[model samples]
Target: MSTPDTTQHKLIVLDMAGTTVADDGLVELAFTAAAERLGEDPATMIDYVRATMGESKISVFRHLFGGDEARAQLANLAFEDAYGELVADGRIAPIPGAAEAIAELKEQGRTVVLTTGFARVTQDAILDALGWRELVELTLCPSDASGRGRPFPDMVLAAFLRTGAVDDVRRIVVAGDTSYDMLSGVRSGAGIVAGVLTGAHDEPALKEHGATHVLASVAELPALIREFPA
Candidate 1:
């Protein structure tokens, strides 16, 4: 609700989907499209797909679609095809003020890191669309030194390591939009857990999951960073 005190906050971590990109119903559309493509029950798979907000495309698909090989194939095909359609249609854009936020964080001598369940290939397209291919300092995907993904904290720790920041696991802030993002932040013992409603989850859901701070969007980040009473 309040702008976090970030004037001296050396690091800022970001979530990709709602935090940065305009998904245009991509997540849900992927599952529905995949189900139709695979000739399966979309209802049975909805739970897994919705639950996969913080998982890699392959991991999520594998869990939802069932089986390893089929999951990988389906994920690759579904995501690639969906993305291709999205690109061809050309409505994707970075969330408002996202690039500006990244740029300002750098201007303030802060190291900006992006961690997402999205794959590197998918992430590349989103970043390129956002015009942020060179604006960040770490992590193209959830995998780090540890292959583990979100809700496990490996990626968060990886960001800290890459930035050469405090690894005490107590001075980092993980800001995101999904419950999985909150879980990842808390599981990692990030000093702060800031959630935004711009993504799939709302403020109430974020609080239910362990977010101590909730902002309207990443656009309010600078204000949050500059005014926290901490």
Candidate 2:
């Protein structure tokens, strides 16, 4: 009997905001604007927002509003609008070499999927701003994966099922810049959960959360993937 080839990672799932796109505090700024617009004080929630950087925005709002679905929906809308406007202003940029790394991954016959915690509208706006509408074969928002995002393996599993890239979940590679990203990857049973330092959390937080490897930036990811044992 022949054994399955399990050496190479075939599916790559990457986070959008902090991993590939350099938002530079736009999420916090948008949260503040949204809170102010909703007649709430940003101070009461900014810390939570910062702490849960890679979580679904609507999920955050749901918690902040104490499960008031209406308020959470409103807040999520306002936050998405504020974020879309900032993206329109060109406040976000691709992390240096992020695009190249993705391209290289694709060139190597690996499937790349971009996942974000933002709503579909905001995710689209950021992609449009970066001219990355087609950068990867798939781009997922929390909504795309049954409305679940990081800290829950929904998006990662969604990518696995939707792309049909690899037969084994252990062949998936998940990369991001936050601890939640690490948790999601871990929950999904991915082969590698790599945390990059170009965004929210630091090395210790990522490592503590479940990151198998810590990198300086997404730019180093291609080489890491290539050098990973088969």
Tens-digit lDDT track of model 2 for 106-186? 998899999999988888898899999889999998889998988999999999999999988989999999989999999
Question: For each candidate, what is the lDDT?
Answer: 0.74, 0.93
Q: Which regions of candidate 1 deviate over 4 angstroms?
A: 1-8, 66-69
lDDT by residue for model 1 over 102-126, one digit each (tens)?
7876787777898877667666777
Clashes of each: 3, 1
Candidate 2 wrong stretches, greater than 4 Å:
1-7
State which candidate has the highest TM-score. Answer: 2
What is the number of residue pairs that collide in model 2? 1
Clashing pairs in 2: 7-230
